[model samples]
Target: MITVITFNPSIDTLYKLETFEIGKVQRAGDVKKSAGGKGINVARVLNQLGHSPMCMGFVGGYNGLYIKDEIKKIGLRDEFIKIDGETRVCLNIIDKNKVSTEILESGPIVEENDMIKFERHLENILEETKILVASGSLPKGLPIDYYGLLGEICRIKNIKFILDTSGKYLESAINSHIYMIKPNIDELEALCKCNINNKEDAIKEAYKLLRYNIENICISMGKDGMILVNKDSIYEIKIPNIKIENTVGSGDSSIAGFAYGLLNDYSLKDCLRLSNACGMSNAMNIKTGFIDVNEIEKLFKEIEVLEYSKI
Candidate 1:
């Protein structure tokens, strides 16, 4: 089973309006809400793609209950630890031109005792988990090393750990034995402390992190597709362009697709194709992490993977 860790989960409100003007009140004809955060998004996509993924993290207050209820409503298991602080709510505003703007909360402040309880809970879950995907930012009052601690647990237990986060948490956690990581250019730059000017630069930078024991590095480049870097081979995946409804959760969906392909023992080329397909499919979706199997199947055939010289 796949277990996803979201240190700071939330209810995501997406407003699609005709146009968003600063210092002006605008009306939105459509609005949607869902349980979100990178890990949870991964879990949702994993589940949609025929995988068993249970979500675990810290939650609190009425908003937290709503998050749990929403997860239940979707038929996924919720194993979140209850905390004292209220969970966060994030907003994404998109105009008719497809321009996206975000307003995110810092999330709850987790206490020391809460951390202990969560670790104990995660330990039990780890026993049944074949892979652990930890993503998102550290909540207030939680040390940056929190994700690293979980990575250590996965390392000790021999669980395949896939991490998608950035900044200090990612820096600290990369030192642990990680199976894979999905980083956009910004995240890749943050880890390597340099600019990713192009695909070759991304490949070079991704290799730098492999020294940290990270087996696979999936570099997402938005509309430009992605680059898959590992010790064995380097693959560049490109997705067929289509109308994009929302780019939110596309990266998480890509991670889920890649993990799913690995679980099925697909080849690197096929895995990269599947990952890009999932990401592109999510772009056509209104709700984050939602995808139709038919869309995925059709997209799988359209994705192109070009392998470069191995390292």
Candidate 2:
């Protein structure tokens, strides 16, 4: 089983409107609310794909309970750390055109001692873990290097670690013994300290990440597909694009697909295929982090993985 960690989970409210006008009251036609966090999003997708994922994170107050219930409602096996502060709530407003606007909240405040307790909780579950995924932002009072510490523990336990975060959190964990990471192209550019204007630069810069001891790096470009970087081989994966209902959680879906691939010991080429297929299928539906098995099967057949050339 894969383990997912969400430092700051929330209640995500998606409001659908015909059109949103500035300074005017808008009525939503349909509204949906559920658990929202980078890691939690991946967990939901994993459950949908018939995988058992154990989710761990911080939640408190009534909203926290609501988040827990929503996780169970979606059939995600979960174990959350209860805190004193109320969990956050985030808003996503989608217009008829499928354009989305978001309002996000910073989640519960966690004391330093509480972080220790979380690590202890993690200890009890590590034996069941095949891969450990820690995603999203750092909660209040928790150190940025917390993810790095997680990497350290995973290394000692011989479990693969996959990190998907940004800024200081990414910086701190970049040098850890991570099995893989799914940083979008922009994040990739920043990490490599150079702009990736073409395929050559994309491959070259991605290889630079291996210097930090990262075993694999997947840089996803929305329409251009994704680039895979490794020590022995490099490949570029491109897929047919479909009309996008919503782009939210597509990245998380890709992460879950890749993790699922690694857990099953699929070849790198096959893993990239699964990742691209899952990501593309997510855009085919209105629900975030969701995919139609039929959509995934069709897209999986259309994926093309090519060797790169500097020429």
Candidate 3:
């Protein structure tokens, strides 16, 4: 079974407005809310694809309960650790032209005891989990090495670990030698400590991670698709261009797709194909990770994969 760990979960409130004026009273045309966080988004997409993923994370207070109810409404399984502090709410305001301005909260502070409870929850789930995905930011008061610790545990338990995060957490996870990592161009550049100007540069930087023991590396470049690098090979994959309704959670969806492919024993190329398709499909909807299987199937045929080798 697939298990996702979100250190910080939230209620994502999205608003649509004809125009956004800073420091002024503005009216929204439409509003929507949902359970959010990178790992939770992954679980939601995996569930849509007919896979039941158990979402594990810290949640508390009224907002936390709302998040849990929202997850259940979407038909996704969850096992959240109850904390004392209230959960956070993120705001996404989209203007008439589809330009999104996001305001993210720092989230509630997690006490040491809260962390312990979450670890215990994770420990119990790890026993039956085949794929363990740790994503998004760490909540306040939690150590930055949280993902790293989880990755190590997964390694010791022989579970396939997929990490999606940024900054120190991501760096720590890389050091732990997790099974796979999905970082966008910006995150990749930050991790590699160098500017990636082209595919050649990306491939060069990706090789550096291989020496660090990262089994598989996927660098997602938005519309340019993604580049996959492993010990044996490197490949470039592209998705057919499409109208993008929202880019949020595209990376999370891609991670879910890749994990799904790995779970189904798909080749790396096929895995990337599905990954790109899932991302593109998510882009066609306003909500994060909201996708249609029929759309994914149609887009799957349009993805192209090209293999590359060190020159």
Candidate 4:
């Protein structure tokens, strides 16, 4: 079974407006809410694609209950640790031009007891998990080594682990020698503290992670597609052109595709192709936690994979 862990979860409220007038009375044409967090989004996409991923994370208060109820309504299985403080609510305003403006609140503080409950939940889920994906930001009061520790636990339990996060959490997880990591160009640049101008540069930076004994690395470049680096070869995938309605949760979808492929024993190239397809498919939707399986299959064929010598 695939398991996804999100330390910071939220109820994502999306508002659509024909025109977002600043400092004026603006009315929304449409409003929707979804259970959101990077890992939860991944699990949602995986569930839509016929994979029932177990979502494990921290949730609390009324907002947290809403998140749990929404997850159940979507028919996804989850085991979240309840905390004292309320989970956050994130606002995404979509303008007429299809651009999204986000106002995200910092998540509630998780006390030591909350951390203990989370660890217990993680331990229980790891027993049957074949693939574990740790995604998103760490909540306040949690150490940066949170993901790193989870990565270590996965390694010890002999489960393949995929990490999708940024900043110190991702930095620490890199040192934990995860099985795979999917970081966009910006996140990669931030990790290596340098510019990744092209596929070659990305491959170069990805190779550095090999020193940490990480098995595979995927660098996603929006519109430009993605690059996959491993010990044997580098695969450059170019996604077919499509009109993008939204970019939110695309990365999480990509991680879901990759994890799903791995869990199903797909070849590395096929996994990367499917990952890119899922990302592009999510881009066609205007809402988070939304995916079109038919679009994913169509885009799957449109993805071209180029193999290169490992730098």
Candidate 5:
């Protein structure tokens, strides 16, 4: 079983408008809401792919209740820790031209006792968990090396830990025996402190991460697909472009796809193929972290995973 841990979860509210002006009253053409956070998105996509992932995180108040109900509605096991503080609400306003303006909340502060409860809960789940995924940012009041602690625990359990986060959190977990990390081009550039102008550059920068003890580094390049690097081989994955509706959660969907492939014992090339297809499929949908299996199947065949060393 795969387990997903989202430290800070939220109710994502999306608004679609013809135009958004600063300091003006604007009417929205459409509105949507869903249970959100990086890890929750991954769990949603995993559930969509027929994987019953155990969703663990902190949630509280009415919005938290909504998240719990939504998780259950989607047939995922809900293991969220109840807290006193309310869950946050993140707003994404998309204009007619497909430009997104975001307003994100810092989320509720988690106390030390909350982390204690979470660790206890996580310990109980590791026996049944094969892959442990910890995504998103740490809520306020938690230490920066929180993910590193989780990685160490997963390391002792022999479970594959796939981390999807950025900045200091990503850096903290680099040497903790992580099985994989999925960072986009911008994040990769920030981490490696170099500009990646092309696929070759992405491959080279990704190689720098191998020394951190990360077994697999998947660098997403948006429309250019992604580059996957391991100790022995490098693969350049290419995906056919389609009409994009919303790009949020595409990375989480990719992580879910790769985790699914790993759980099913797929080859590395096939794993990258599914991962890229899932990300591409997410872009074609309005809902975040969602994909139609038919769409994924179609995109899967179109995805090209080339062994870079042989090119």
Candidate 6:
């Protein structure tokens, strides 16, 4: 079974308008809302791909209730621990030209007791989990090394832990025997504290992360495809150009695809191809974290994965 963790989940609200202006009253042409977090997005895509993923996190108050109901509506298992504070609401304002503006709220603080409860809950879940994917940022009142703690546990249990995050949180888990990490180019740059001018540079920077006991590193370059570096080989995946609708959850979708491929024992090349295909498919849809299975199947054959020589 695959388990997903969202340390800070939210209710994602999207507004579509003809155009957005400063200091003016505006009417939205369309609005959509759903349960959202990087982990939730990964689980949503995994479910659409015919996998049932268990989602674990914190939720409370009315908005948390809404998130619970929405997760039930989506047929995902809810193992969320109830907290005292309300879950956050994040907004995305999109205009006719496809530009996006975001206003995100920092989630509620978690108490020490609640943290203990979650750790106990996660421990039980890990017993049966084959792959564990943790995404998004840490909430208030949680230590910076929270993800690292989980990684260490997964390592002891011999479960593959795939992490998607940036900055210090990513740094915290660098030595925890992580199975994989999917970071976009900017996030990769931030983690490495260096500039990546091109694909070769990305590969070079990603290769350095291997010493941390991370087996696979996938660096996503929007529209330009991705570079995957591992101990054995490196792969450069190319995606066919297509009109994009929304790119919000593309990286999470890619992680889901890669996890699914690993579960099925697919080769690294095939895994990267499926990952990019899922990302591209998500970009073609208006809903975040959604993909058409038919589109994925059609795209799988079109993606190009070329092995890169070691630097």
Predicted structure with the largest TM-score when compared to the true one: 6
TM-score per candidate = 0.97, 0.96, 0.97, 0.97, 0.97, 0.98
Candidate 6: tens digits of C-alpha lDDT, residues 1-311 = 89999989999998999999999999999999999998999999999988889999999899999998998898899999999999999998989988989899999999999999999998899888999999999999899988888888988899999999888999888888899998888899999999989887888888999999899998899999988899988888888899998889999999999998988899888988889899999999888899999999999999999996676
* Top-lDDT structure, candidate number: 6
Per-residue lDDT value at 118 in model 2:
89
Residues 1-31, model 5: lDDT tens digits: 9999998999999999999999999999999
Model 1, C-alpha of 218: deviation from truth (Å): 1.1
Global lDDT of model 1 = 0.88
C-alpha lDDT of all candidate models, in order: 0.88, 0.86, 0.87, 0.88, 0.91, 0.91
For model 4, the superposed segments whose C-alpha errors exceed 4 Å read none
Tell me the tens digit of each residue's lDDT in model 4 across 1-311. 99888889999999999988789998999998889988999999999889988888889899999988988887888688888889999999999899799989989998988898788777888888999998889998798788888878877899998989988888877878699888888899999999878877888999998888789888889999988888988898998899988899999999999998999999888999889999988888987867898998888888999998866
Taking the candidates one at a time, how many backbone clashes does each contain? 0, 0, 0, 0, 0, 0
Residue lDDT tens for model 3, 29-56: 8898889988888998898888988988
Across residues 208-252, which tens digit of lDDT does each residue of candidate 2 receive? Answer: 788988988888889899988888777889888688888888999
Q: Name the runs in model 3 displaced over 4 angstroms.
A: none
| Residue 23 alpha-carbon offset, candidate 4, angstroms | 1.9
